[model samples]
Target: MLNELFTLKGKRALITGSSRGIGRAIAMLYAEAGAHVIIHGSKPSAKLDEALAEARALGASAEAVSADIGDINAVKGLIQAVGDVDILVLNASMQHYQTVPDFDPETFALDVNANLRSCFLLLQGFLPGMQQRRFGRIISIGSVNQWRPGARLAIYASTKAAQFNLVLNCARAYAADGITANSISPGVIDTDRNAEALADPAIVEKLRSLVPARRFGSAMDCAGAALLLASPAGAYINGADIAIDGGMKL
Candidate 1:
Protein backbone atom coordinates (compact mmCIF):
# COMPACT_ATOMS: atom_id res chain seq x y z
CA MET A 1 0.00 0.00 0.00
CA LEU A 2 2.87 2.34 0.78
CA ASN A 3 4.45 1.65 -2.61
CA GLU A 4 1.09 2.03 -4.31
CA LEU A 5 0.64 5.48 -2.84
CA PHE A 6 3.85 6.63 -4.52
CA THR A 7 3.18 4.93 -7.82
CA LEU A 8 2.69 7.10 -10.92
CA LYS A 9 1.26 4.46 -13.16
CA GLY A 10 -0.33 5.73 -16.41
CA LYS A 11 0.51 9.33 -15.61
CA ARG A 12 2.43 11.64 -17.97
CA ALA A 13 5.07 14.02 -16.65
CA LEU A 14 6.79 16.91 -18.40
CA ILE A 15 10.07 18.03 -16.84
CA THR A 16 11.90 21.04 -18.29
CA GLY A 17 15.70 21.50 -18.40
CA SER A 18 15.95 17.77 -17.96
CA SER A 19 19.04 17.17 -20.08
CA ARG A 20 21.18 17.26 -16.97
CA GLY A 21 21.39 17.97 -13.26
CA ILE A 22 18.37 17.97 -10.95
CA GLY A 23 15.91 17.84 -13.81
CA ARG A 24 17.53 14.71 -15.15
CA ALA A 25 17.38 13.07 -11.77
CA ILE A 26 13.67 13.81 -11.40
CA ALA A 27 12.86 12.54 -14.87
CA MET A 28 14.68 9.28 -14.27
CA LEU A 29 13.00 8.74 -10.93
CA TYR A 30 9.54 9.55 -12.26
CA ALA A 31 9.95 7.07 -15.07
CA GLU A 32 11.04 4.44 -12.62
CA ALA A 33 7.96 5.17 -10.55
CA GLY A 34 5.80 4.51 -13.67
CA ALA A 35 5.07 7.87 -15.32
CA HIS A 36 5.63 8.28 -19.00
CA VAL A 37 8.24 11.02 -18.73
CA ILE A 38 8.90 13.76 -21.23
CA ILE A 39 12.47 15.09 -20.91
CA HIS A 40 12.73 18.69 -22.07
CA GLY A 41 15.90 20.53 -23.05
CA SER A 42 16.63 23.99 -24.38
CA LYS A 43 17.54 22.50 -27.72
CA PRO A 44 18.03 19.24 -29.51
CA SER A 45 21.12 17.59 -28.15
CA ALA A 46 22.77 14.28 -27.57
CA LYS A 47 22.22 14.69 -23.86
CA LEU A 48 18.46 14.74 -24.27
CA ASP A 49 18.61 11.70 -26.54
CA GLU A 50 20.75 9.84 -24.05
CA ALA A 51 18.36 10.59 -21.21
CA LEU A 52 15.44 9.28 -23.25
CA ALA A 53 17.37 6.12 -24.11
CA GLU A 54 18.34 5.55 -20.52
CA ALA A 55 14.76 5.92 -19.30
CA ARG A 56 13.58 3.40 -21.85
CA ALA A 57 16.30 1.01 -20.77
CA LEU A 58 14.94 1.30 -17.23
CA GLY A 59 11.63 -0.08 -18.58
CA ALA A 60 9.91 3.28 -18.71
CA SER A 61 8.20 5.08 -21.56
CA ALA A 62 9.99 8.38 -22.30
CA GLU A 63 10.53 11.02 -24.95
CA ALA A 64 12.75 14.05 -25.60
CA VAL A 65 11.48 17.56 -26.37
CA SER A 66 13.19 20.89 -26.99
CA ALA A 67 11.97 24.46 -26.61
CA ASP A 68 12.99 27.91 -25.44
CA ILE A 69 10.52 28.34 -22.64
CA GLY A 70 11.44 31.99 -22.30
CA ASP A 71 9.59 32.83 -25.50
CA ILE A 72 5.82 32.80 -25.52
CA ASN A 73 5.56 31.43 -29.02
CA ALA A 74 8.01 28.70 -28.22
CA VAL A 75 6.13 27.85 -25.09
CA LYS A 76 2.96 27.51 -27.13
CA GLY A 77 4.77 25.25 -29.50
CA LEU A 78 6.04 23.23 -26.59
CA ILE A 79 2.55 22.81 -25.22
CA GLN A 80 1.33 21.69 -28.59
CA ALA A 81 4.09 19.15 -28.70
CA VAL A 82 3.36 17.85 -25.23
CA GLY A 83 -0.45 17.91 -25.52
CA ASP A 84 -1.45 17.44 -21.86
CA VAL A 85 0.74 16.28 -19.00
CA ASP A 86 -0.46 15.21 -15.56
CA ILE A 87 2.67 16.61 -13.92
CA LEU A 88 4.57 19.74 -14.87
CA VAL A 89 7.98 20.52 -13.37
CA LEU A 90 9.22 24.02 -14.05
CA ASN A 91 12.96 23.58 -13.65
CA ALA A 92 14.38 25.80 -16.36
CA SER A 93 16.02 29.01 -15.05
CA MET A 94 18.61 31.64 -15.89
CA GLN A 95 21.08 33.03 -13.35
CA HIS A 96 23.20 36.14 -13.88
CA TYR A 97 25.22 37.44 -10.96
CA GLN A 98 25.44 41.22 -11.29
CA THR A 99 24.98 43.99 -8.74
CA VAL A 100 22.04 46.33 -9.20
CA PRO A 101 24.26 49.07 -10.58
CA ASP A 102 26.09 46.66 -12.86
CA PHE A 103 23.12 44.61 -13.98
CA ASP A 104 22.05 44.97 -17.59
CA PRO A 105 18.40 45.81 -18.18
CA GLU A 106 18.20 43.41 -21.09
CA THR A 107 19.65 40.60 -19.00
CA PHE A 108 17.18 41.27 -16.22
CA ALA A 109 14.37 41.15 -18.72
CA LEU A 110 15.68 37.88 -20.03
CA ASP A 111 15.76 36.43 -16.56
CA VAL A 112 12.18 37.51 -15.92
CA ASN A 113 11.03 36.02 -19.16
CA ALA A 114 12.66 32.70 -18.39
CA ASN A 115 11.89 32.40 -14.71
CA LEU A 116 8.51 34.07 -14.31
CA ARG A 117 6.80 34.53 -17.63
CA SER A 118 7.50 31.03 -18.78
CA CYS A 119 6.05 29.62 -15.60
CA PHE A 120 2.92 31.67 -15.98
CA LEU A 121 2.47 30.70 -19.61
CA LEU A 122 3.04 27.02 -19.00
CA LEU A 123 0.44 27.04 -16.24
CA GLN A 124 -2.01 28.81 -18.48
CA GLY A 125 -1.50 26.32 -21.25
CA PHE A 126 -1.72 23.27 -19.00
CA LEU A 127 -4.21 24.31 -16.34
CA PRO A 128 -7.35 23.81 -18.40
CA GLY A 129 -6.52 20.22 -19.09
CA MET A 130 -5.82 19.59 -15.44
CA GLN A 131 -9.07 21.23 -14.43
CA GLN A 132 -11.02 19.14 -16.87
CA ARG A 133 -9.42 15.99 -15.55
CA ARG A 134 -9.60 17.25 -11.95
CA PHE A 135 -5.98 16.33 -11.32
CA GLY A 136 -2.62 18.07 -11.64
CA ARG A 137 0.80 18.37 -10.06
CA ILE A 138 2.83 21.51 -10.65
CA ILE A 139 6.30 21.65 -9.14
CA SER A 140 8.60 24.61 -9.47
CA ILE A 141 12.30 24.28 -8.72
CA GLY A 142 13.11 27.19 -6.42
CA SER A 143 16.18 28.23 -4.48
CA VAL A 144 17.29 29.08 -0.94
CA ASN A 145 18.27 32.41 -2.43
CA GLN A 146 14.65 33.51 -2.06
CA TRP A 147 15.19 33.83 1.69
CA ARG A 148 18.95 34.45 1.80
CA PRO A 149 20.23 36.62 -1.00
CA GLY A 150 23.95 36.73 -1.52
CA ALA A 151 25.90 39.32 -3.53
CA ARG A 152 24.79 40.03 -7.08
CA LEU A 153 21.65 37.87 -7.12
CA ALA A 154 18.93 40.51 -7.14
CA ILE A 155 17.06 39.44 -10.26
CA TYR A 156 17.47 35.75 -9.63
CA ALA A 157 16.18 36.03 -6.09
CA SER A 158 13.28 38.20 -7.11
CA THR A 159 12.20 35.74 -9.76
CA LYS A 160 12.41 32.86 -7.29
CA ALA A 161 10.37 34.78 -4.74
CA ALA A 162 7.72 35.33 -7.36
CA GLN A 163 7.77 31.62 -8.16
CA PHE A 164 7.01 30.73 -4.56
CA ASN A 165 4.07 33.11 -4.45
CA LEU A 166 2.79 31.82 -7.75
CA VAL A 167 2.81 28.29 -6.42
CA LEU A 168 0.79 29.39 -3.40
CA ASN A 169 -1.70 31.24 -5.54
CA CYS A 170 -2.03 28.31 -7.88
CA ALA A 171 -2.68 25.98 -5.01
CA ARG A 172 -5.43 28.21 -3.65
CA ALA A 173 -7.09 28.59 -7.01
CA TYR A 174 -6.97 24.92 -8.00
CA ALA A 175 -7.27 22.92 -4.82
CA ALA A 176 -10.94 22.32 -5.48
CA ASP A 177 -10.02 20.72 -8.77
CA GLY A 178 -7.64 18.32 -7.09
CA ILE A 179 -4.59 20.24 -8.25
CA THR A 180 -1.58 20.88 -6.06
CA ALA A 181 1.22 23.37 -6.62
CA ASN A 182 4.48 23.46 -4.70
CA SER A 183 8.07 24.65 -4.83
CA ILE A 184 11.20 22.76 -3.92
CA SER A 185 14.07 24.97 -2.84
CA PRO A 186 17.54 23.49 -3.09
CA GLY A 187 20.78 24.80 -1.67
CA VAL A 188 24.28 24.29 -3.06
CA ILE A 189 23.80 21.09 -4.96
CA ASP A 190 26.91 19.55 -6.50
CA THR A 191 25.98 19.58 -10.19
CA ASP A 192 28.11 20.31 -13.21
CA ARG A 193 26.51 23.73 -13.47
CA ASN A 194 28.19 24.65 -10.17
CA ALA A 195 31.45 22.89 -10.88
CA GLU A 196 33.42 26.11 -11.30
CA ALA A 197 32.06 27.64 -8.13
CA LEU A 198 32.84 24.52 -6.07
CA ALA A 199 36.30 24.11 -7.54
CA ASP A 200 37.78 26.84 -5.36
CA PRO A 201 38.69 25.49 -1.94
CA ALA A 202 37.83 28.69 -0.10
CA ILE A 203 34.44 28.97 -1.74
CA VAL A 204 33.65 25.31 -1.13
CA GLU A 205 34.60 25.54 2.51
CA LYS A 206 32.62 28.73 2.98
CA LEU A 207 29.44 27.24 1.50
CA ARG A 208 29.83 23.95 3.36
CA SER A 209 30.30 25.75 6.66
CA LEU A 210 27.01 27.56 6.22
CA VAL A 211 25.06 24.35 5.63
CA PRO A 212 23.88 22.45 8.72
CA ALA A 213 24.58 19.27 6.81
CA ARG A 214 28.18 20.50 6.36
CA ARG A 215 28.28 19.26 2.78
CA PHE A 216 26.96 20.11 -0.64
CA GLY A 217 23.76 18.34 -1.68
CA SER A 218 23.27 16.06 -4.66
CA ALA A 219 20.82 16.21 -7.59
CA MET A 220 19.25 13.02 -6.23
CA ASP A 221 18.31 14.90 -3.08
CA CYS A 222 16.06 17.19 -5.08
CA ALA A 223 14.77 14.24 -7.07
CA GLY A 224 13.69 12.39 -3.95
CA ALA A 225 11.64 15.34 -2.78
CA ALA A 226 10.17 15.74 -6.27
CA LEU A 227 9.10 12.10 -6.35
CA LEU A 228 7.14 12.44 -3.14
CA LEU A 229 5.51 15.69 -4.19
CA ALA A 230 4.54 14.40 -7.64
CA SER A 231 3.12 11.17 -6.30
CA PRO A 232 -0.16 10.29 -4.58
CA ALA A 233 1.57 10.42 -1.21
CA GLY A 234 1.86 14.20 -1.58
CA ALA A 235 -1.69 14.95 -2.77
CA TYR A 236 -2.67 16.74 0.40
CA ILE A 237 0.53 18.87 0.48
CA ASN A 238 -0.31 22.06 -1.31
CA GLY A 239 1.03 25.61 -1.60
CA ALA A 240 4.16 24.82 0.42
CA ASP A 241 7.83 25.32 -0.26
CA ILE A 242 9.85 22.24 0.63
CA ALA A 243 13.44 23.28 1.18
CA ILE A 244 15.83 20.49 0.30
CA ASP A 245 18.77 22.63 1.26
CA GLY A 246 20.31 20.58 4.07
CA GLY A 247 18.81 23.05 6.53
CA MET A 248 20.76 25.94 5.06
CA LYS A 249 17.89 28.34 5.66
CA LEU A 250 17.65 27.22 9.27
Candidate 2:
Protein backbone atom coordinates (compact mmCIF):
# COMPACT_ATOMS: atom_id res chain seq x y z
CA MET A 1 0.00 0.00 0.00
CA LEU A 2 3.03 2.28 -0.05
CA ASN A 3 2.26 3.26 -3.62
CA GLU A 4 -1.33 3.92 -2.69
CA LEU A 5 -0.13 6.42 -0.08
CA PHE A 6 1.18 8.55 -2.94
CA THR A 7 -1.92 8.28 -5.05
CA LEU A 8 -3.95 11.44 -5.66
CA LYS A 9 -7.02 9.85 -7.22
CA GLY A 10 -10.21 11.88 -6.85
CA LYS A 11 -8.25 14.84 -5.47
CA ARG A 12 -8.68 18.22 -7.13
CA ALA A 13 -5.63 20.47 -7.16
CA LEU A 14 -5.35 24.13 -8.16
CA ILE A 15 -1.82 25.28 -8.77
CA THR A 16 -1.25 28.98 -9.46
CA GLY A 17 1.53 30.08 -11.85
CA SER A 18 1.63 26.57 -13.27
CA SER A 19 1.94 27.49 -16.95
CA ARG A 20 5.71 26.95 -16.68
CA GLY A 21 8.67 26.14 -14.44
CA ILE A 22 8.46 24.46 -11.04
CA GLY A 23 4.74 25.04 -10.78
CA ARG A 24 4.26 23.36 -14.13
CA ALA A 25 6.35 20.42 -13.04
CA ILE A 26 4.27 19.94 -9.90
CA ALA A 27 1.02 20.26 -11.82
CA MET A 28 2.06 17.62 -14.33
CA LEU A 29 3.26 15.24 -11.65
CA TYR A 30 0.07 15.58 -9.64
CA ALA A 31 -2.00 14.86 -12.70
CA GLU A 32 0.14 11.87 -13.50
CA ALA A 33 -0.52 10.65 -9.98
CA GLY A 34 -4.31 10.80 -10.62
CA ALA A 35 -5.35 14.28 -9.59
CA HIS A 36 -7.86 16.49 -11.34
CA VAL A 37 -5.40 19.34 -11.83
CA ILE A 38 -6.24 22.97 -12.41
CA ILE A 39 -3.34 24.67 -14.13
CA HIS A 40 -3.50 28.35 -13.26
CA GLY A 41 -1.53 31.16 -14.86
CA SER A 42 -1.57 34.91 -14.53
CA LYS A 43 -3.16 35.34 -17.94
CA PRO A 44 -4.65 33.10 -20.59
CA SER A 45 -2.28 31.85 -23.24
CA ALA A 46 -1.69 29.05 -25.69
CA LYS A 47 1.04 27.87 -23.32
CA LEU A 48 -1.50 27.50 -20.51
CA ASP A 49 -3.82 25.45 -22.71
CA GLU A 50 -0.90 23.28 -23.71
CA ALA A 51 -0.22 22.46 -20.09
CA LEU A 52 -3.85 21.55 -19.54
CA ALA A 53 -3.75 19.36 -22.60
CA GLU A 54 -0.61 17.68 -21.33
CA ALA A 55 -2.28 16.85 -18.04
CA ARG A 56 -5.17 15.31 -19.93
CA ALA A 57 -2.70 13.37 -22.05
CA LEU A 58 -1.36 11.96 -18.78
CA GLY A 59 -4.80 10.35 -18.35
CA ALA A 60 -6.05 12.79 -15.74
CA SER A 61 -8.79 15.36 -15.64
CA ALA A 62 -7.45 18.91 -16.05
CA GLU A 63 -8.34 22.48 -16.87
CA ALA A 64 -6.70 25.92 -17.07
CA VAL A 65 -7.60 29.26 -15.55
CA SER A 66 -6.15 32.77 -15.59
CA ALA A 67 -6.15 35.76 -13.29
CA ASP A 68 -3.93 38.57 -12.05
CA ILE A 69 -3.12 37.01 -8.70
CA GLY A 70 -1.66 40.22 -7.40
CA ASP A 71 -5.10 41.76 -7.58
CA ILE A 72 -7.45 40.68 -4.78
CA ASN A 73 -10.55 40.87 -6.98
CA ALA A 74 -8.86 38.75 -9.60
CA VAL A 75 -7.79 36.28 -6.97
CA LYS A 76 -11.41 36.02 -5.89
CA GLY A 77 -12.38 35.37 -9.45
CA LEU A 78 -9.73 32.70 -9.71
CA ILE A 79 -11.07 30.96 -6.61
CA GLN A 80 -14.56 30.98 -8.08
CA ALA A 81 -13.23 29.55 -11.32
CA VAL A 82 -11.60 26.58 -9.63
CA GLY A 83 -14.34 26.01 -7.03
CA ASP A 84 -13.18 23.85 -4.10
CA VAL A 85 -9.75 22.29 -4.44
CA ASP A 86 -8.42 19.64 -2.07
CA ILE A 87 -4.90 20.84 -2.78
CA LEU A 88 -3.85 24.49 -3.27
CA VAL A 89 -0.41 25.50 -4.48
CA LEU A 90 0.48 29.14 -4.07
CA ASN A 91 3.32 29.43 -6.55
CA ALA A 92 2.65 32.79 -8.22
CA SER A 93 5.12 35.40 -7.05
CA MET A 94 7.04 38.51 -8.24
CA GLN A 95 10.46 39.92 -7.47
CA HIS A 96 12.22 43.29 -7.85
CA TYR A 97 15.97 43.64 -8.03
CA GLN A 98 17.04 46.99 -6.61
CA THR A 99 19.50 48.08 -3.95
CA VAL A 100 18.14 49.95 -0.96
CA PRO A 101 18.85 53.34 -2.43
CA ASP A 102 17.52 52.34 -5.81
CA PHE A 103 14.45 50.53 -4.50
CA ASP A 104 11.17 51.82 -5.84
CA PRO A 105 8.25 51.98 -3.45
CA GLU A 106 5.83 50.86 -6.12
CA THR A 107 7.90 47.83 -6.96
CA PHE A 108 8.16 46.90 -3.30
CA ALA A 109 4.40 47.12 -3.01
CA LEU A 110 4.01 44.98 -6.07
CA ASP A 111 6.22 42.31 -4.56
CA VAL A 112 4.24 42.40 -1.32
CA ASN A 113 0.96 42.19 -3.17
CA ALA A 114 2.02 39.38 -5.45
CA ASN A 115 3.90 37.30 -2.93
CA LEU A 116 2.56 37.82 0.58
CA ARG A 117 -0.78 39.54 0.20
CA SER A 118 -1.92 37.21 -2.52
CA CYS A 119 -1.18 34.21 -0.30
CA PHE A 120 -3.33 35.68 2.43
CA LEU A 121 -6.15 36.33 0.02
CA LEU A 122 -5.97 32.81 -1.36
CA LEU A 123 -6.05 31.29 2.10
CA GLN A 124 -9.09 33.41 2.80
CA GLY A 125 -10.90 32.00 -0.21
CA PHE A 126 -9.74 28.35 0.09
CA LEU A 127 -9.28 27.76 3.79
CA PRO A 128 -12.97 27.59 4.64
CA GLY A 129 -13.55 24.88 2.11
CA MET A 130 -10.53 23.03 3.37
CA GLN A 131 -11.72 23.30 6.93
CA GLN A 132 -15.16 22.08 6.07
CA ARG A 133 -13.82 19.21 4.05
CA ARG A 134 -11.36 18.34 6.80
CA PHE A 135 -8.84 17.24 4.22
CA GLY A 136 -6.67 19.82 2.48
CA ARG A 137 -3.10 20.47 1.51
CA ILE A 138 -1.71 23.98 1.09
CA ILE A 139 1.73 24.28 -0.42
CA SER A 140 3.49 27.58 -0.93
CA ILE A 141 6.66 27.95 -2.96
CA GLY A 142 9.15 29.77 -0.78
CA SER A 143 12.72 30.91 -1.54
CA VAL A 144 16.13 30.28 0.01
CA ASN A 145 16.43 34.06 0.21
CA GLN A 146 14.25 33.88 3.27
CA TRP A 147 17.10 32.43 5.29
CA ARG A 148 20.05 33.67 3.21
CA PRO A 149 19.28 37.09 1.90
CA GLY A 150 20.98 38.26 -1.29
CA ALA A 151 21.79 41.75 -2.44
CA ARG A 152 18.84 43.70 -3.88
CA LEU A 153 16.47 41.02 -2.66
CA ALA A 154 15.27 42.60 0.57
CA ILE A 155 11.63 42.79 -0.44
CA TYR A 156 11.68 39.34 -1.96
CA ALA A 157 13.33 37.87 1.10
CA SER A 158 10.86 39.58 3.39
CA THR A 159 7.91 38.20 1.52
CA LYS A 160 9.39 34.72 1.51
CA ALA A 161 10.09 34.87 5.22
CA ALA A 162 6.54 35.95 5.85
CA GLN A 163 5.31 33.09 3.71
CA PHE A 164 7.12 30.61 5.94
CA ASN A 165 5.57 32.15 9.01
CA LEU A 166 2.20 32.14 7.35
CA VAL A 167 2.51 28.47 6.59
CA LEU A 168 3.32 27.73 10.21
CA ASN A 169 0.32 29.71 11.40
CA CYS A 170 -1.90 27.96 8.94
CA ALA A 171 -0.68 24.59 10.05
CA ARG A 172 -1.51 25.45 13.62
CA ALA A 173 -4.87 26.92 12.78
CA TYR A 174 -6.06 24.07 10.58
CA ALA A 175 -4.38 20.99 11.99
CA ALA A 176 -7.49 20.24 13.99
CA ASP A 177 -9.43 20.25 10.78
CA GLY A 178 -7.03 17.76 9.24
CA ILE A 179 -5.49 20.36 6.93
CA THR A 180 -1.77 20.70 6.44
CA ALA A 181 0.29 23.70 5.27
CA ASN A 182 3.88 23.63 4.12
CA SER A 183 6.47 25.47 2.05
CA ILE A 184 9.01 24.33 -0.54
CA SER A 185 12.16 26.39 -0.74
CA PRO A 186 14.29 26.16 -3.88
CA GLY A 187 17.81 27.43 -4.54
CA VAL A 188 19.37 28.40 -7.88
CA ILE A 189 17.06 26.20 -9.92
CA ASP A 190 17.92 26.18 -13.63
CA THR A 191 14.81 27.78 -15.05
CA ASP A 192 14.42 29.96 -18.14
CA ARG A 193 14.33 33.08 -15.99
CA ASN A 194 17.55 32.14 -14.20
CA ALA A 195 19.35 31.06 -17.36
CA GLU A 196 21.08 34.43 -17.68
CA ALA A 197 21.97 34.50 -14.02
CA LEU A 198 23.75 31.18 -14.41
CA ALA A 199 25.20 31.97 -17.84
CA ASP A 200 28.11 34.14 -16.77
CA PRO A 201 31.09 31.82 -16.25
CA ALA A 202 32.24 33.67 -13.17
CA ILE A 203 28.76 33.76 -11.64
CA VAL A 204 28.17 30.10 -12.41
CA GLU A 205 31.42 29.08 -10.75
CA LYS A 206 30.69 31.14 -7.67
CA LEU A 207 27.22 29.69 -7.41
CA ARG A 208 28.50 26.16 -7.98
CA SER A 209 31.05 26.60 -5.24
CA LEU A 210 28.30 27.50 -2.80
CA VAL A 211 26.17 24.50 -3.66
CA PRO A 212 27.58 21.14 -2.54
CA ALA A 213 25.88 19.50 -5.48
CA ARG A 214 28.09 21.58 -7.81
CA ARG A 215 25.18 22.25 -10.16
CA PHE A 216 21.95 24.16 -10.33
CA GLY A 217 18.79 22.24 -9.45
CA SER A 218 15.95 21.44 -11.81
CA ALA A 219 12.23 22.22 -11.58
CA MET A 220 11.63 18.50 -11.08
CA ASP A 221 13.58 18.69 -7.84
CA CYS A 222 11.00 20.98 -6.27
CA ALA A 223 8.24 18.98 -7.89
CA GLY A 224 9.41 15.88 -6.06
CA ALA A 225 9.12 17.54 -2.69
CA ALA A 226 5.72 18.99 -3.59
CA LEU A 227 4.31 15.66 -4.71
CA LEU A 228 5.24 14.04 -1.43
CA LEU A 229 3.86 16.87 0.66
CA ALA A 230 0.54 16.85 -1.15
CA SER A 231 0.22 13.10 -0.82
CA PRO A 232 -0.97 10.88 2.02
CA ALA A 233 2.66 9.88 2.60
CA GLY A 234 3.22 13.38 3.94
CA ALA A 235 0.13 13.57 6.10
CA TYR A 236 2.14 14.39 9.20
CA ILE A 237 4.58 16.74 7.52
CA ASN A 238 2.89 20.00 8.34
CA GLY A 239 4.37 23.46 8.83
CA ALA A 240 7.66 22.21 7.44
CA ASP A 241 9.86 23.90 4.87
CA ILE A 242 11.27 21.29 2.54
CA ALA A 243 14.41 22.74 0.93
CA ILE A 244 15.18 21.64 -2.60
CA ASP A 245 18.39 23.68 -2.55
CA GLY A 246 21.09 21.02 -3.07
CA GLY A 247 22.71 22.08 0.19
CA MET A 248 23.09 25.68 -0.95
CA LYS A 249 21.93 26.98 2.40
CA LEU A 250 24.66 25.08 4.19
Tell me each candidate's TM-score.
Answer: 0.98, 0.97
Q: Please write out the lDDT profile of model 2 over residues 192-229, one tens digit for every residue.
A: 76877778999899888888988889999999899999
Candidate 2 lands at a TM-score of: 0.97
Per-structure clash totals for the candidates: 0, 0
The runs of at least 3 residues in candidate 2 whose Cα sits more than 4 Å from the true structure, single-residue gaps closed, are none
lDDT for predicted candidate 2 compared with the true structure: 0.91
| Predicted candidate 1 versus true structure: per-residue lDDT over 60-142, tens digit per residue | 99999999988889999999999999999999998887877888789989999999999999999999999999999999999
Q: lDDT of each model, Cα atoms only?
A: 0.93, 0.91
| Model 1 lowest lDDT segment of ten | 96-105
Q: Which residue pairs clash in candidate 1?
A: none
Best by lDDT: 1
Using TM-score, give the best candidate's number: 1
Clashing pairs in 2: none
Give candidate 2's total backbone clashes: 0
